[model samples]
Target chain A: MSVLEVNHVSKSFGSNTILQDINLAFEENKIYGLLGRNGAGKSTLLNIMTNRIFPDAGDVKLDSENINDNDTKLGLMYLMSEVNLYSNGTTLKQIISDTELMYGDFDHSFAARLIDEFGIDINQKFGKLSTGYNSIFKLILALCVPVKFVLLDEPVLGLDANHRELFYSELIQSYSDNPRTFIISTHLIEEVANIISDVIVLDQGRIMLDQPVEDVLAKTHSVVGPAKDVERYTKGLNVIGHDTMGTIKANYVYGDLDDRPLPDTVQLSNFDLQKLFIFLTNKYEGSMHSEN
Target chain B: MKTNQVTKYLFKKQIVLLGELYLFAFAIIFLLPLLLSVISGTLSDYSFVGLLKGAHIAALFGIFMIAISTLSYENFKFLIQNGISRKTFFEAQLTVYGILILIGNTINLFYDYLIVVPLTHASTFNTFMSLYADFFDNPFVSVTFNFIFSALLLVFGALAGMTVGSFMTLFSKLTQRIILIATPVVGVVTMAYVANATNNAHYQMSWVVNFAKFIIGENGNDVLNPFPMMGFLLVLSAIMIVIIRYLFAKKQLKKA
Candidate 1:
């Protein structure tokens, strides 16, 4: 029954506004994908939510209480980001112990299993961990801690294909067992496309899209046909972006499609999340120029 | 529950980890006399017990410096990330440092006074046991004053450590460098001022000595009352704890 709410939150670094009046609520027992390009303020927003950094204005609350300095509420949430906040000399085992001591409960057996599966040495010093293993180590903590909300910022930063695959499967299994909320912020959209239930797209310090995956995909589609026929068929539709290949063209359009008869050469396909995200982010500032 | 966990966390980090290094240093310092004796084929009359006592006192300052230098904002960030509030962090520090002071004083008393002084039969070492014997004729009062003085030294070292830690956490690298360069100059100037003030009869009272005497329950009139000194230390410690909390709470994660 817990709900994490960010109300009227805004932050600015000198003249550059990072987050502008961001107001969002996360319900319980759901997976939310936080999608944003570089410098889109994804990490900043996550940092603020976890109390790693204070926002310039407004507050983040858990249920009805302010989360800042509230141990009871903060204990219910965790954030795994790129920052190496762990001390230099601490070992992975010590890290787990410290985390368990702080959060009051941790899945030791599960963490051990994941450590073995990933071939991560629990005795190794945290500072000596490689980039990929560091991510894996943090990912393990994110999964094992018995918290209500886990915000993962770039969870698979240096993970390879095999590790990423293993992580996703383990994540799904963990989610199935615990059914807590997870907000994964990553650039690898295609990999997490099917796993995430909700998609929150941020662009230029603003939330461009916040909807269910199905709803977002339903409203966006690609029309593929000869250049002349494709342009003629979708002239009045909302064309966010498009791709061109000599005579053939596919216009990535958003919004409802008209119930008109289609040409034989025309092909209609559902929009992929990555493509939709690209178009949505690029639609503004006239940067969605068709690739020749 | 949260406070206990944080206390345990800090104890493991600060005491257990750093205690090993400190004990190693103490062992080396304590064994210096034996090593010197072995090299010379005969021990000199210089009191080994006195040397050990001196080393223990130096260890107190070392403890404060090491603790403060090692206590960085990284730990603060780590604790907060794990849901430890600033208040809890402050409480944990005070409890840990206070316990450290008590434990340190007990060990000093046990080995330096009980074992070393008796074994060495060093009469000079007995003087510390009756440090203010000339000023206060009562043996009990003198010993109590010595114990309180030792405790105060430990507490003052801890306060300095906290101040240094807060300075390191609050300022940028450039500002820290500037402060580092200026600290010695400031200390020298203050010491010179105190030395110069000692020449004047009207300013004959050394504030440091007076403060120590006041803490040992002896005022200018040689009055014995420990309550005021004890209360002053408690208040001072409380104020330092508040300062530590405020500095940590206002610590910025990243400099812009």
Candidate 2:
């Protein structure tokens, strides 16, 4: 059993704190969704975890060994970010082969199958790849490398609907086949909500929520009815955020609902991961703004 | 072993690059000119090729190192992407460059002594002999001294390339432009001031001359005494290696 831990990590750029006291443990053989809005420090956290960037006041460790510039420890993890790090003249085949050399193991047949399935010409130079294809290639690297942990930052950037669907299915299949830990950071909450086993919501340089998705969804509810009735029904519950449309309203709650007689126009339904995420991040931002 | 693999790959590329460079250079300087002279029935005539044959092998290797080490940005990006520790890649690259420099200068030594001087009939092409033969009669002692001097220069060239590459990639465009413009202006102004002060005797300039001469020996003897120069170069190289290692410790991913 392998575990990657980010222990009390804090990073700041100039006066702006990117990540503040982030402490999380990722056990192997699970999928975690790292959800955040723009500039919520998702990328910064991922960079720090992968040793691509330094943390100001903490360390990331794999199996109890610090991974900062430790080749043996780092070799067990790979981070696929939205950066073109390969040489312009290198072909995709060559890059993949070189990656295999570095990590000592890569699923060549699976990679070959993926290239064919993705309609990618591996002979083409990496620089000439389209934005969508570039994302696809990086996703392939993330999938094929036989590492214990893989962190993907915006894995589906520039990917079209079909490609994103294909990628998600392949990701699920690969996870099932190998059972490595994957922590994905992306804005596409709805698309990855079902596949992700755990959800980590980041907001305002802090972790707003970190829980199993099923556990989170079990307590989350969308109370929809007349605005006054919905408010009355959820008066004591933890209301994260809500939406109002004229006389009607839907208050999103993060905790259990009270056992009260339902109002005539009131209705209760389980909210989705996206809705939960939206309300959670929105509420956190609101609190941050009020504090400032 | 992984470092060895990395060194192998990098050295392979450098070998290919050096081969191509030598092929092109030798063709222009030796082959083409020799052919032209032969065609014109002037095979024995003195020419530019003979003059250029005097270029030191170590210096040329240093030039080659600068070129490849400057392009090391490409390798850095690739290596860092693959999760190679900075220490691993740095050690691998420096080891490769060191070995290549050693082999390159050794080949130069052999080729000049055996082929160039014998064929061109020009002893001036023998750079090591000209530099050290006056002070040291023993070839072994002289060559050892020459090797240290050449190694220092190549290491400096390699370190300079790494610095330039890092500077180009790490800083913002505005900062780079400002530094680029400011550096030469400052250097020129300082040089003019130094020249003026030295000519007018306004500043004690003997320390300046003495400082330059300090590299020669303890007594500032410039006549074939390479012991002080060797000691100075070794210490300078040691300092540079330490500085370079420190700078390379914690580099994050910059924009490609």
Candidate 3:
């Protein structure tokens, strides 16, 4: 059964509709990648699910129970976003203690290890921390909080390459040790591509694609060869996007590859997640541009 | 039990943060004035002791500001992000209000008993709103009256603080801007009216005068006893809670 269900959720700010008819369900013990471009309503949908902001219509449910103003259901989820809800004078240690108070038990030993690995001073005031350290500290709290579901928006915003690698490994370790659902919204598509099992793509305040990572990749195939031969080979299929380099061409297709033999000049390869995401989003943008 | 745990945690955080603010305000409002008085060697007509007592009132107002500032969106969001719902957060704030009122009035009582009554040599200390000094004729009764009366003052300040904070939180940008510009004008106009009424006996600023008289156990040459002002405060507290809850329910946390 789905642990969390977002049904027909819609939100608007003034004249701008932030989310429109968003329907989603998250199963237990899966890493879900929430992929969307800037201003694509990923954060808005996350905020709505967590009840930080009210939706204009529809509702979010956790375990068949409404999440809004329901302490028991809300207690089952935690959201760590870019906004620093904490005040300037609060120390990291104090924040952790406060989190423990609210959420019952916390993984203190793992948190301490993460803190040491990240070289963060627990006594330092929140406002004194640098930008990268801010994200790191929030990530630590997100990982340690004893909630069944954790939603992280732009979780790795300001991390260096080394820190990002360390975070991913630690996340995997934690998930393996204690299986729980994690919905991470981020722009670094390639980094989380392997880590995430399910992928949900949002564009222009609407869900464009939602499927398993392997399934999405399997459906999207790339045909590369001479420009004319590639076109002939992918004549009737759904061509999402294409790139031309001198005499060679690569056309991305999103449909079942037929059993019919192809020309020798044409080559086919499995679609990478990053390439598939770019082509899918760009295809939607291209349609929008044409419509406008 | 969960609600109690969240309330306890929130109360501790607010108290620590407010304790820092109170210390800072004490330095500026109370200590600075005392230092100036000491350096000048009682140059003013009023006794240095009276000046010090007056500074304590100013410090109380300063604490009220601290309380209002602490009830901000940043703090509210912090509480909610930690899995505390808005309902729980509101309940926690109510607890905070009680805490502030209790601690504030207790400190005021301690000051009146330990410092004002024993150390000061003044024959009479005229408390502006409560006539607390008049109660001094009966030492035991005076302490009791002062505690009750000071609690009322602290309640008023606490209510005002929460109201100001909720007003700032719930209003739109345009409404907030208008309020920011209009508050000083309103204060000045009220002060002018109060000053004018002070001189004319016919004007009868009985709301202030009668309130003070009643708290100090007197009715001021009236045929009938005064209506209980404490009842009004209790009712006001209920109204304030409703208004604050409504405002909080409507408030939206904008991203920063």
Candidate 4:
């Protein structure tokens, strides 16, 4: 069953609409990636889904009930990138105590273990911590909070390479152990591409693409060959993206790659998420060829 | 977690915010008196009794600062975003701010007795206590009156600040930028008005003397008892709090 449903939701600031008629459904026990460009209303959508921001129109429901209902039965948690814990004079230990008090299922032991693993100082004030550590601290709390639906918005924005790897590892482990619905909204598509079971691409406050990772991957492929041959072979195909180097050309094609073998001068390659995202998002200016 | 669970989280946030405000209050209270004494070239003969009285008045400034600092645009935005009922959040902040001010006053009074008294003259402690006794002589009447007046000032300040903060948050970025420039100008105008109202020749002004009477009690000759005024202030404050809470609850959490 779907764990989250947003139905024709719209949000406007004064007369300027930020999100319009956005609709989506998310299932349980799956890792979903929410991909969008900046100001595409990705965070706004997440905020509305998590009940942080109310929609101007329509409704967002969790477990078949309006999320704003005071039932206390729906387990939902949102970790926003902007709404951080107190930055100054609050120790990690104090934050843990406060979290435990706030979240009934907050696991202190798990938090402590994560803190140790992340090498965070228990006595250091949150304000004094580096940006990477600050993000880690929030991540630790987010993971330990036992909520059925967890929404993480750009969780790795400020982390170092090593910490990002560590965070992803911990996130995967936590999801495996808990089996909850996790919606991760990020611009770093390539980093989370392999782990995301489902993908939702948002563009201009609307769902541009929503499908299982396998289905999405299946529809996209890259063809590389001599420039002239590659162009000729992909002439009638839906080309999402393309690149060229001198006489060589590479093209990202949408739809079944297995239905047709590569031409003699062309080689077929599997599409990666980075290339796919670039192709899908950068397809506006005649970058994608229509099958017509 | 239950709805009550969020209260605990909010209280923790309140404590952290209050601590910062308390420190800010202390710095202002301690520094102002010292700065005034130095500027007057009376540092050598600075009377502890005078300093104690000044500190008491300075401590009251914390109520204003607390009102301004706590009801910030970001805080209101946060309260709305977190799904905290505005009534609950406002009451929580008021409760927290009241507690912090009381604690801050106690500390200021203590520091007056300990440091200021010793630095100037220990003999003046009795005089200071007498003044305090005179100020708080009729415990039931004086306490009721002062409490009501203080609560009114706090609520008024908080509401005004919240109104401005909310406006800033709801307005466009360009408007906010403009208001950022106008804020200090508005502040200066308010100070000028206050100065004119409290000038010596205008000391008999009904509002001025009424406010002073609430703070320091009747100046021995005043025939008007402040009990009714106290009751009126209390009722007004309660009404304002309710209105502010209602507005805040219904207001949208618009982003800047």
Candidate 5:
């Protein structure tokens, strides 16, 4: 299996750092959810990996070969950035045709189907497309390009509820049909929770958590009930965060549970991916503030 | 990635643009004379081919090149999004311009002979052949001289256009604004000073005339050899190409 590796990558704009010694490895045939807060270096990391921007320190390698300025290796991956790089006057059909030419291979039939389903006029200029259609067209490109790895940054930026759901379904179908690696960085966590096999979380220029979605969800629990009982039951565990309402409280813990008997009016249950992500990122960010 | 393929694509686009320009120029070049003849009933008096000469072609080609340079930013964004590296992008852009400089000069030469020469019975219509053709006994040698002279001018003009284009695209907005503001201010000040009848201004104007004489190899009665002008163009173009390449390599792309 082919793998993409980022070795000790660090990036900054001026004196303000964006990514700090970030190290990551993504293998083939896996869907990864890259979660990060606003300005958490998610876009910068994706851009650096694709060589859209350079990293100040370290390099990106694919299959142990340096991909920097290497056309053969760079051709095997694609990054659908948030900004549209195609000319404004170019029609969608022309853009698709040019993209196919550049990549040397494209799923024309699949692209046609997506274009039709999305009700996009192929003859209309890219500049004329609304924000939703722009994102739709970009995502279609991300899914259709015949590459080993597809990195999507804000894939559903302007997508509506219906379109987002359609996109997720199509994404799963495409993965099942093609079996390529996908690294999707987005703020919509609950939606991609069940879709991505692995989750990598970033907070304040650091990798806060990287684990399989199932493992992350399994280790995470919400101790809900009376405030005192919940606190007692969750004491000494990795209590990342909590929500309290008067006498009642729910503690979000992320670790192995103790074998102690449950006290009266205290209950324990599993938490979703979004809650765990929130807890992890908020804890690290809060810690940074406290340290400062 | 696939730098050759990308270069070929860019070259084709430039050719298409050039072809459109040729079509427009040809229409105006050929049709305007006929229109004037119909309206005023006199065609022999009007200078048709002389209106467009080698220097004029150089200026037109320079403008075409400047336009191409302005598009470099948009092209860079598109190509980078398609996974083309900066090195490949620079190589492809230079290659396209290098090829265009040759091809464009040849096409201009072809048009001058095929269209302009037949229209006017004049022996020499281009800047080089107008003054320097007497040195060459044969018409073929004179035409070749015209081609070389025009090509050298085209290259120098292209370098100038690329400089302007690179400046506009590669630099920060503030830097561009400062340069834009300063160039005209400096130009107007120098023009005002040089326009004066002072002895210093006359000395400066005489120096310019002497430089022109040296370029033309003119001692009032000698053959105007173009070797000096060719050498000057080649050296200046080499230096400007280096500066342009440095700017290309060092440029950090913006999000816009």
Candidate 6:
């Protein structure tokens, strides 16, 4: 069943429209990746879904009820990059106390354990923590909280490589243990490619792609062959992106890869999420520029 | 569960704010007086009794400051974004502030009796009784005049703070900018008004002037009339608070 449903939602700031007639549904017990470029309205859509911000038109429902009627649906943890916990005088212990107070099922023990694992000083004030540690601390809290849904916006934005790997491992482990809905929104698409069960690509506030991760990967393939042969073979297919090198060519093609056979000389590779995102956004940009 | 959640959140917030208030009160009551006593020694002849009275007045002013400062844009934003309703939040703040003011007043009264009276070799009980008499004299008159005037000042200060805080919320992107620009302008305008009013006798006694006098304790006509001015300020404050709560209830948090 869909745990979250956003229907025909539109949002505008003055004359600049942010989200336009967007619709999406989130299923329970799945890890979904929400990917987009900067200023693509991904965060705005998340805010509307979480009831942090109201939409100009349309409604978001959680568990079949309007979110505004019961904003406790916001009790569903939303760890946005911008919506920081207190800084200056606030400590991790105080934050835990606050979280336990505000949320019914906050796992204090789990949070403590995660804090220990992340090497966060419980006594240190939030403002004193390094940027990477700040992100780690927030991620730990989001993972430990026993809410029905958890939305992590750019959770690993400041993490080093090691911490990023550790974050993904902990996130996966937590999901496996609790089996709740998790929506991870980030520009770092490839980092979460393995963990996300579903992928939703947003562009200009519209959902460009929403499908199972496996299906999305299977539908797109990269072809490397002679430039003329690649162009001829890629004709009538949706070529997301292409590059040429000394009479040889590489093209990112989107379609049912399993349904067609390529020439023996052509090298085929599975499309990575990062490459897919870059291709899609670049394609949109190219089209817009051409139109202009 | 809802009550527990709100209480916990509000309690945490209040604890932090109270710490700041204590520091502020300590500075104003203990430190400032000590500095003044050292600077001129003008208060040296007054004895501790006068010092206690001064402290009592300072404490009352501190309570007013605390009440006003508690209403902020951050608090409003939290109320709107979190599941906590604006009505509930405002009621909680009012309840907390009222309790705090009562406690502060009690402590001040105790200090007046315990420390001031003995030091001055004065009858503290007699002073208390006289003050009470002063408060209730001509039941209708004193109630209308002094008591109501002071109450209105407190309410007006709080309403002013909340209204300004609400306006600050609208300039969310450039809150610091707005504050930086508006603070000096407000300060200058207020000073200019004060200077102008002190020089103009007719302007001072106008109905507007009388109302301002009633607020600031400058009205010389002390025929102990139940200060309807206090009721006026209270009702005005109540209206502003209601409007503030309504606007806050409808507000939404900005997106990530």
Which predicted model would earn the best DockQ? 2
What is the lDDT, from 0 to 100, of the residue A221 in candidate 5?
A: 85
Task: For residue A8, give model 5's deviation from the true position in Å.
Answer: 2.7
lDDT of 2 at B117: 66
4 or 5, which is superior by lDDT? 5
The TM-score of candidate 6 is: 0.80
The fraction of reference interface contacts (C-alpha pairs within 8 A across chains A and B) present in each candidate is 0.64, 0.62, 0.76, 0.14, 0.53, 0.26
Chain A only: TM-score per candidate: 0.93, 0.94, 0.96, 0.87, 0.94, 0.92
DockQ, all models: 0.49, 0.58, 0.55, 0.14, 0.48, 0.26
lDDT, candidate 1, B59-170, per-residue tens = 6544754475346677787886687776677778777777777776666656655766666665444323443435556766866766676676578668767867876777
Candidate 2 matches the true fold with a TM-score of: 0.90
Candidate 5 residue-wise lDDT, B72-155, digit = tens: 777777776777766787778878887997888887677678766676656666678777878778888878878888877777
Q: lDDT (CA) for every model shown?
A: 0.81, 0.82, 0.80, 0.67, 0.82, 0.69
Candidate 2 chain A lDDT trough over 10 residues, lowest sum: A279-288
Give every collision pair in model 4.
Answer: none
lDDT of 3 by residue, A34-93 (tens): 998899999999999988888999999999898877788888888989988887888989
lDDT of 4 by residue, A1-292 (tens): 6568889999886786788898888888999999987887888887777555568899977778776533242345545454553546778887677556545667777787788888989898877978788888878877887677778888987788988998999899999888888899998898999999999888667777899999988888688999988888888898888888989999889877445556898988688766777666756423334533
TM-score, per-candidate, Cα-based: 0.85, 0.90, 0.84, 0.69, 0.86, 0.80
Question: What C-alpha RMSD does candidate 4 show over the true interface residues after superposing them?
Answer: 4.5
lDDT of 1 by residue, A172-261 (tens): 999998899999998889999999999999887889888888899898879999999999889899999999999999998888988877
Candidate topping TM-score = 2
Candidate 5 C-alpha lDDT tens digits along A1-292: 9999999999988999999999999999999999998889999998888877789999999999987776777788888877888888989888887777778889988888888888788899999989999999888888898899999998988899999989999999899999999999998898888899999998878898888888988898888999999988887888988999999999988988979888879888999989888888888878888999
**How do the residues A187-229 of candidate 2 rate in per-residue lDDT, one tens digit apiece?**
8999999999999999878998898999999999888999999
Error of 4 at B199 (Å): 19
- What is the Cα-based lDDT of residue B2 in candidate 4? 43
Docking class of 5: acceptable
